[model samples]
Target: MTFISLRNVTTLYSLENVSLDIAEGELIVLLGFTGAGKSTLLNVVAGLTEYQGEVYFNQQNMNGIPTERRDVGYLLQDIYLFPHLNTFDNIAFGLRANSCPADEITEKVEAILALLHIGHLKKRYPKDLSGGEKQRVGLARSLVMEPKILLLDEPLASLDPATARNIRKEFKALHNRLNLTTLYVTHDFTEARELADRIVVIINGELKQSGSAQDIFCQPAPEIQEFIAAAN
Candidate 1:
């Protein structure tokens, strides 16, 4: 069943109709260049930005829901690890904010560190860790909350190619293993092809085309065709 549904959705800054229904357990990628409104799309879903139209997730209508109450986790391209806190505390920040039990926080944070194979870095601070390690902690922090949906806005955009590819691999593996309903925004064609069950194209503040990755790659519309050619 569809986990997140956007119907005839329109935002103030955008001119075209925006609609999408993301299925449960699907990793959907919104592929577009900068200024394509990809970031705005994700912000709207995460309830950080206002928009006009219907949006529902996990059966909850999101028309007027506030960002904090939306239960949507967003991992931005800029990784915001706390400089003062160690990896464990950074990952525990969300749970603590939600007033989770002390014992539970300890258990959850430890499990995440182990799960992401970052157990050894639990005591390390953000300044001490590598770019990839920092990202892993950021991801672990988000996933531990078990939000209804995860929105990633060019999460790997700032990384070196090798680091980005490596992180994306871990993301895909974890996403599939957990069957998490996720929305990923990227301009990287390889990232789109590797991580998405379906791909949505956006251009000039509008959604242009959307379909299975294979459908999009094999049968491209004019705009998409031109864009792909240029990207290549």
Candidate 2:
């Protein structure tokens, strides 16, 4: 089933005439360089940006749905954990805002912490955590919300290579275990190659190509041919 669909999604600023469909439990990677409208497309689905198009979730038009009501868990490259909050509180912030009961909040937070392997760091503050740890905490914060869709924008771009690789494995595992429909944006070819169920290439705010890894690599557009060669 198509879990998310965007039709002629032209953003007010960058993206133009874009359309994509993400199946339930599928992970789609938006592969593009900076200023390529990858993030703008993400913001469009997140309902954070104005666009002239139709965005649908489970066949229901999300035209005027507010961001909070969209049931989307968004994690950006910049992990902003509140300075005053510890790991537990940071992840619990959203639930707290929704006025969830204290006991239920603890249960949900702890489960996500364990799933992300950040259980031990729950008591520690953001300032004391490493880069990878902070990213995991931020991921935990998003996952703890139990969203139906997950949108990640270069979530591990700031990490060291070794750490990024390890977290990439964790991301794959989480996606499989949770089975959430995910749209991830990144410029890292390796990340897209390893993680995407399907890779969609965007250039200058337009979707240039989309297909399986082999399909894309076998018959890439001119720009993407250069991109693949440059990555290699």
Candidate 3:
């Protein structure tokens, strides 16, 4: 059931001895304060950050895999939609880049739009759409590529409170529906509670504790307790 595994992973900027395993189809939330190496850990998984340990995807070595070859999808806080492309074009951008067949690209784009419940907004540009809509478009674009693992780095951080909550709900629903293994990075405990099957708390660049929601929330270790207290 294990789909992703990191062993003795160490990142730059003073993060040392970081690691964890993510189950197949599981949603893992990286919980930590800012600059806790949450984003660096995600990039390590995505092959976007350099690390000294081994990363495995589907039990295969990911040591030499480039970001493109790793088949990991990353969703950032900004969504980063192309300025010139409309919603549909942005969604299909990856497909076009990867040289997916034209008919297949259209079908995939349409399916993702419908799956995300934004089929009607495909014609709109990011400028015209609301924050929630733009985020969905970013997600669908990543999902369309059918990456082996999806990585989210505080995808909900920049939204207004109400929008962030609603979008996280939609994201959790989508995660369940698609059943894709996702590594979600966030500082919000509430969002982590809603999305993660496993909670991994990292502080000062090291893993403090990791387990199910009940275990992490109800019986937090001292480091986790300190983190929660500090956050509140």
Task: Indicate which candidate wins on lDDT.
Answer: 2
Q: What is the lDDT of residue 41 in candidate 2?
A: 92
* Candidate 2 C-alpha RMSD relative to the actual structure: 1.1
Whole-model lDDT values for every prediction: 0.88, 0.93, 0.89
lDDT of 2 by residue, 1-232 (tens): 9999999999877898999999999999999879999999989999998899999999999999999999999997798889899999999999999999999999999888888888999899999999999999999999999999999999989999999999999999889999999999999988988999999999889999999988788889898898778767
Would you estimate the TM-scores of all the predictions? 0.96, 0.97, 0.96
Tens digit per residue, CA lDDT, model 3, 105-201: 9999999999889999999988998888888999998999998799998888878999898888888888888899998999998998888888999
Candidate 1: regions farther than 4 A off:
none
Cα displacement (Å) at residue 121, model 3: 1.9
lDDT of 1 by residue, 38-109 (tens): 888888898877888888996779888898888877888777888999999999999999999999999999
Off by over 4 Å in 3: none
Clashing residue pairs for model 2: none
Clashes of 3: 0
Q: Best candidate per TM-score, number? A: 2
**lDDT-based ranking:** 2, 3, 1
lDDT of 2 at 219: 88
